[model samples]
Target: MKYVDEFRDRDKAAILVREIGALAACIGRQIHIMEVCGGHTHSIFRYGVEGMLPSRIELVHGPGCPVCVLPIGRVDACLGIAEQPGVIFTTFGDAMRVPGSRKSLMQAKAEGADIRMVYSPLDALAIARANPEREVVFFGLGFETTMPSTALTILQADREDIANFSVFCNHITIVPTIRAILESPDLELDGFLGPGHVSMVIGTAPYEFIARFHRKPMVIAGFEPLDILQSIWMVLKQIKDGRAEIENQYARVVPEAGNAAALRAVAQVYELREFFEWRGLGSIEHSGVQLRAEYARFDAERKFAIPNISIADPAACQCGEVLKGLIKPWQCRLFGSACTPETPLGALMVSSEGACAAYHQYGGKVQRAETA
Candidate 1:
């Protein structure tokens, strides 16, 4: 309660709001600050942070949710792997519900495919150890924060001589994707709310380019309301003082250098792919990780033969524009009405950390006020 209660003081929150309002008025321009973490998006909405801010300050959501950015083709590929003889597919719970071209992994599970929801790659490796005769594939997906854990599991499997264990790597980096968003002609961002968890892996050095080249202020924030508010204040202060730099609001958790051992583990097991497909962002160069040549035997794609197919998203979903900060979640015609989380028309709705789902669950009041 020491750290938690202190950051949530109502009086402190009100004072911060007043200060932010003053700063917003001083800027005199429509300042668009995008929060690149899905957790930050959820926190902002859940705490009504957007409603408390000045109207001039706009918070755009970025492609930070791993489950949301996973391409439909990748889901289909996982299904293909799951259906193979003597194969058991494992992944995080979120991936199970994300729809592929025709069916979700959950649907595949119901149809008798060996699809297990695992919390970590280690759990999948344990399964592989238990069933030595059957092939086990861990469907890995996330940004830098989760990659080290996956990398460690692969190393553990190799060390223990677990021949049946393989990895279907869909791990991506945050920096390259952020560069893509910043360089896009349609987006007009003034600053960035950098991802906290991803920063804990790659450190703050990678994000210096956003400030140095693009002159965009960035504040890496935690998931709490006060942490987000303090980060907003940091961004506003930088803008007010005409300084562009990277500031870490979640200093208690994230350091400037980050965890070196975890980074080394990821470097040991994976190499950057030339191009990787995202659900909405298409193929981003050097944005994803694949098993290195040394680890090819443990690569699921290499171990199995499957047809390559590219499928388009639903015609009505505007998830592409939404992810890129070109439009808001509510701007998508299918949002809430035709595409609720229970029956998502797009990946954005299915992911818990997705901008659309956050808006649907917590920003409905703000949406009504805007319409009124």
Candidate 2:
């Protein structure tokens, strides 16, 4: 608990596993728990936490990977902006590989588009400042965790009067996505392992709806192996006690009230869109944010002629089903063959945090063959 190694302690993990098993046995039915964060999905596979769980508990992967959840139309739109003459398109490296309708940003770069990967939005702003003559657009994406930084960076651009810089804001919200999943007709989730990173920004307050309305318990969890196992035990405890509540196991990093300054910056720079499309989850009302009209000068959508068209995935891709937790990554026929990380055909395989990418890297080979 004190250090990284402490959170990965095998002994402590074993104890929590046993406790989880004991509690899981009391439920007398299958316990389908969803880890509503892509980071948690990657950690579960990387640390082999899924194998450590009891047979009764199933940890379903959710649409928590912000990069993986962006719909194809959005990528196509980014591609259009990137290909424009004299425009410098900057985005996180993982996003370069997300398949656009015609080609990914990586492919576009190879074909002479000035697509550069930067660590943060500020880096894009710096590129804009350094090259006053060229248009610099940062392809901003992610949940609440990455929004504040982008917002602050945009504010800086405004203060500095960087007219050449703009943001292609594809930032989405978490609460609406979670609510959409819960509202799905066939969703079978028993409880949830909430995202730790997003919780640090938005806090545990928003998740009270899950417990209060849906009557499902959710524990905001950290990414370490022990943190995951302990959270699993915490969720199992609620099930055995017939309780529904939102608990924060990541309280050491995530304050219940959230980051006030970050929230303020985001509020000042952006406003909720009427609706936004997700790769697998489709359109969820107010699930994404856009630049406020006051910041319209720095909004890429308003600045550039983007082809904002909704696109369906490849005919063979089952990423939508996998994202909905209706199918495992390996269950998709294209998993390791046509859809390997090197030549990804869907959003899930484009990012490290995505469930399909995690499965292909850590496990699911034998199952993949069965489906293949």
Q: Write down the lDDT of every candidate, Cα atoms only.
A: 0.88, 0.90
In angstroms, the error of model 2 at 204 is 1.2
TM per prediction: 0.96, 0.96
- Residue by residue across 1-372, what tens digits does model 1's lDDT show? 987888777899999999999999998888889999888888888778898898899898888999998988888999999998889999999889998888899999999999999999999999999999999999999999899999999898888989999999889988889999888889788888889999888889999999999999999998889888889999999999999999999888898998899999999999999988888788888999999998888999899865656787778789878887777888888878898888888868888788888888877547956875
Evaluated at residue 120, the lDDT of candidate 1 is 92
**In model 1, how many backbone clashes occur?**
0
- In terms of lDDT, the best-performing candidate is 2
Candidate 2 vs. true structure, TM-score: 0.96
Q: Count the backbone clashes (under 3 Å) in each candidate.
A: 0, 0
Candidate 1's C-alpha lDDT? 0.88
